[model samples]
Each structure stands twice: as C-alpha cells, then as structure tokens.
Target: MSPEAGTGSPIGGTLPRPRSPATRDLGMRASLLFPDREVAERYYLPLIYTACRTCYSELEPQEIFDRATSGRVTTDKQQDLIRRVIESGHGSTIEHIVFTFAISGVTRTLSHQLVRHRAGVAFDQQSQRYLDYKRPSYMVPGTIADAPVEVRERYLAEMDESLAFYGEMLEAGIPGEDARFVMPNATRTNLIMTANLRSLIHMSGLRLCTMAQWEIRRLFQLIRHEIFTVSPFLGSFLAPKCVPLGYCDEDRNRDEHCPIRPHKDNVLAAWAEKRAAAKAKGREVPTL
Candidate 1:
C-alpha cells in the first residue's frame, strides 16, 4: 500500500501531528568529545567566572583567570559569579569555553537542520563525495516502519532498490558524487560539531521545542541527556525557548495544542482585559 493511499491528512496542517513513539533506536549517537565533567567543573566555571570578574575588577584578564583557575577563589564563589553573569545576559562570558561532540548515524535530514545553526558552532561532516559508500545505510521514520506490514515492506523495498541502483551505477563507472544523487534524505551521515555553551543553549532552545521536527527533536533530547550526564548545572539551561520565555510564540502553536507553555496571544489577551478593567476604573496600569 502506498503511503499516499494510507493517510488523508493535509501536507501542512496547523495542528501538531501525532508522533510515533521513539522506542525504535534510529542508531543516532551524540557523544561529547571534550571536557568531561571534571574538566568542565574545574575550568569551565572558572573561565566564565574570570570573564565576568575581569569586567568589575581592575586586575588584568590573566590575573583574573589565574585567580579563578587556582585555589585563590573558592568553587562556590566562582559559580556564584558565573551564574550571576549568565542570568544577567552577559553571553560572551559563557562563549569562552566550548564543547565538542562526535555525532553519528543521523540522517541527512537532521544534519541539514543541525547545520542551519551558524553562530559559534562548527561542523565537520563525513564527506559523501570523498568516500565511496560500500555499505550504505539509511534511517526509517518510526511512523513508516510501524505502518501495515505491506506498507512497511513497500517502504523498505523502495530504499533497497535505490541503494541497489546506486551500486549498479558505481559498477557502470559512474562517479560517487553523481551516484549519490540517488540517495534520499534518509541516508545516514556523521559529523563532528563544536559549539560554545551559549550556542549550545541557543540551539537546544529551538530544537527542544514541541513544534520541532520529531527526528531533530529526538537528536536534541539525546544531546541534552549527554550534557546532563556531564554537568547537570549547565544541562539545566538546555530547555525549550518557551520554557524560559513562559509563553509559546510559534504561530502554529497559537491554538495552544502543545501544553508545554501557554500561548503568548492568550497571555496578552488576559493582560489586555485587566488593563481595560483598570482603565474603566479611571486607574492607569503601569506597563512593564
């Protein structure tokens, strides 16, 4: 059975789509390559702390770094300063330290979205052009894989045939670059990504949102977990933007379908009502 014949849903519905359970392992992996918890705990906080302290202290930057790195400043004191600076929106302080991750087995679809984050992040992706794929593998969406037996088999067969044709093209003296055109978005790929803490948090905010694509959202979920394993304090900041903003700003989410955060429109409407009431009583409400 063709997938088109199976579902009557519109292509771009405003309502959130029902996501299949993420129980199936898509073989996605995101491993932190730098700064294990101890390193992060020892230097990351101090680095940011030094950056923050250098602003207020008359001392040189190196002196601040030395004091923060050495036992001159206590951990509690360093963390307190770092936390205050971060909360006050001094993002550059956090940018002094970076985290690297070795990500593998993600589909090209996810990689394309991941690379859209251009600020403070660097990516080194596995080159499809340089290496001939002797055994190409691809990801299957959970929804497609959990379809009716016939539908599932059809999907699998199509992927198999595409790869087989790719192999046939290679045998016929076709260049790998040209043969790779047949590869679908599901084609698995690997990448090495490096991003500062600030950028990581920013990326997490968007990708962790309920409105994000299911696969990419899952990827961020894995990333957040990895960060949490190393530093829960830093990991605590890796949440949906709405989680921090206290309101959902997404246009499609105006219907309040996703309950993670209240719709911004509703919040504004409620505030307007309160202001109207206050105005009627001849009292001006002070705007924040």
Candidate 2:
C-alpha cells in the first residue's frame, strides 16, 4: 500500500513534526578566504585603530596607521583602545576592516534568511537561472530523515521525483530559469559573503542565538569558528546579543525554554521588586 494512503496505523495518523536533533549531516561549509591571520593581525587592527584614534589624536590617519602597524603603539594599547571604542557604541570605527567568506552547500532556505542582512554586507549567490544543474543536490532535515521508515522512504521518493521532473523539464527545451522553479527550499547552493567587522558581529549576535533556526544557527557557528581561527580577539565579539545585554529579548523565549540567558521580562520584574523594596525603605533607586 502507498504510504500516503491510510493504513489504519498510529504512524499514519501522526502529524508532521518539527526538525529534530537527530544529527543529520548538513554538508555546509564556511571558509574565510581573505586576510589570513598574519595579515589581519598586522593590518586589520591597525586600520581600525587609525579610524578610532583619529578622533583623539592630532596625527594624520596615515601617521596613526603607521604608528600602529610599526609597533610605535603596542598591540595591547591598540586593542585596549579599540575595545573601549567598540563597547562605547562607536561602531563606525570597526567598519574599516572587512572579512570575506566562501560559503557552500547551504540550502536555499538558509541562504534566503542569510541575505536578509543588508547593512555593511554583500553577497554573490550562485544563480540558478544561469547555471543549469546537471545533478542538483539537496538537504534533508533530520526530522524527515529520522521519521518512521515508511514515512522517511516516502519523503525521499517525493524529493527524487521532484528532481527527476526538473531534469525532464530541462531536457524538454525548458530554460534553466523556468526549470529551477521546481526546486525545493532544500536545494543546495553556494555564495560569496563579505561583511565589515561591525556587520559580522551584528549578524552573529542574532544568528548565534539559541532560538535561531538550526541550520542558520549552525552556519553562524561555522562562521564564528572561522573568525576565531584567524583572530580570537575579533571572534570574541561574535556571540549571542543576550550575552552582552544580560537578558534574552526574543518573544519566543519569554517562557525561558532555551536558557542561554534570563528572559527580559523576568529581569524587569525582579528589578521592579527590588525598586519597590528600596522605596519602602525610604531610599530611592535609579530606574534602568
């Protein structure tokens, strides 16, 4: 009997489930392609230092950059000033240096979400309209792959049928652009992503959150690992925003399901209680 036909079994009546933690290999890759560690260590920090120090120093930008790169200003001093400037919300200082990544094998679903970040970042994605895929690849979510054997086989068969139909369309003199209309969100693609340090940090803050979609969250994890390999100092800044803010702001996290940080509402409620106690003691407490 066809799996889709009711078989009077409990599994046949089950609803589709969310993606699970069944450890399916996603085959995603994020490689840092520009500014190796030595180059980044020598020039990247100096560049940002020049941008920041220009506000406080009489020296020309060139002079400051030369001083920073030539070690007239120690690395410690440069990093110290850069850290202070960044923590002070002076993001323009960090916008001077950029990192480039060669990202591959990610699903269209992940790429769609990734390209939503527009500020200080650029992307060149593989064009389905231009490249006629002779043998297209795709991703399968863990939940689908780990479902009951009959259900899993049925899902695979559907994916195979879709791709086969796409190929048949291409062979029947259909344009690649039109043929690609049949591709699923699981279709894999590549891209080149470039972003300034500030934008990378901002992107990471949201993508690295526990509440983020698993695939994109994993992609950011790889991105963070790549950054850490080159410059741990810069990578240190790539973390969930709540780590710095001390409270999670995600609406879905109000129930505190993923406890990477306390929910903002709970934190505010605690603060209100503290303030009430202080007011009762005739000592006024400052509001956050």
Please report the candidate that would top TM-score against the real structure.
Answer: 2
Residue 73 of model 1 has an lDDT of 91
* Winning model by lDDT: 2
User: Candidate 1 on 237-261: residue-level lDDT in tens?
Assistant: 8999898788999999999988998
Clashes of each: 0, 0
Residue-level lDDT tens digits of model 2 in 197-251: 9999999999998778888988888999898998998899999989878899999
RMSD of 2: 5.3
TM-score of each: 0.89, 0.90
**Cα distance off (Å), candidate 2, residue 281:** 1.4
Q: Alpha carbon lDDT of residue 266, candidate 2? A: 100
Q: Would you list the C-alpha lDDT of every candidate in the order shown?
A: 0.83, 0.85
What TM-score does structure 2 among the candidates reach? 0.90
Off by over 4 Å in 2: 1-24, 285-288
Candidate 1 TM-score, true structure as reference: 0.89
Model 1 alpha-carbon miss at residue 256, Å? 1.2
